[model samples]
Target: MQIWIFSYLHFLWALNKSMIIEWTHKRKNSHYISMIR
Candidate 1:
């Protein structure tokens, strides 16, 4: 049961990390587009 909880937490952390990365990338792209205009 403890192992299952640990793995679940790890999965959540990884998901959060990927979401942050994707959000930052999207923001950077929008900034670039605005600059071009």
Candidate 2:
């Protein structure tokens, strides 16, 4: 049971990390586009 909880938390952390990375990437892309325009 302890191991299962640890793995679940790890999974959530990884998912949140990926989402943050994606959000930053999108923001950078939009900034570049606005600069170009």
Candidate 3:
């Protein structure tokens, strides 16, 4: 039971990390597009 909880939390953390990275990437891309315009 304890191991299962730990793995679940780890999975959430990894998912959150990837989401943050994708959000930042999108933000940077938008910024570049605005600059180009």
Can you tell me which runs of candidate 3 are displaced by over 4 Å? Answer: none
Clashing pairs in 1: none
Q: What is the Cα-based lDDT of residue 1 in candidate 3?
A: 100
User: Could you tell which candidate, 1 or 2, scores higher by TM-score?
Assistant: 2
1-37 per-residue lDDT for model 2 (tens digits): 9999999999999999999999999999999999999
**Lowest-sum lDDT 10-residue window in model 2:** 1-10
Across 4-26, the per-residue lDDT of candidate 1 in tens digits comes to: 99999999999999999999999
- Candidate models: Cα lDDT each: 1.00, 1.00, 1.00
Overall local distance difference test of candidate 2: 1.00
| TM-scores of the models, in the order given | 0.94, 0.98, 0.97
Q: Which candidate comes out best when scored by TM-score?
A: 2
lDDT of 3 by residue, 1-37 (tens): 9999999999999999999999999999999999999
The collision pairs in model 3 are none
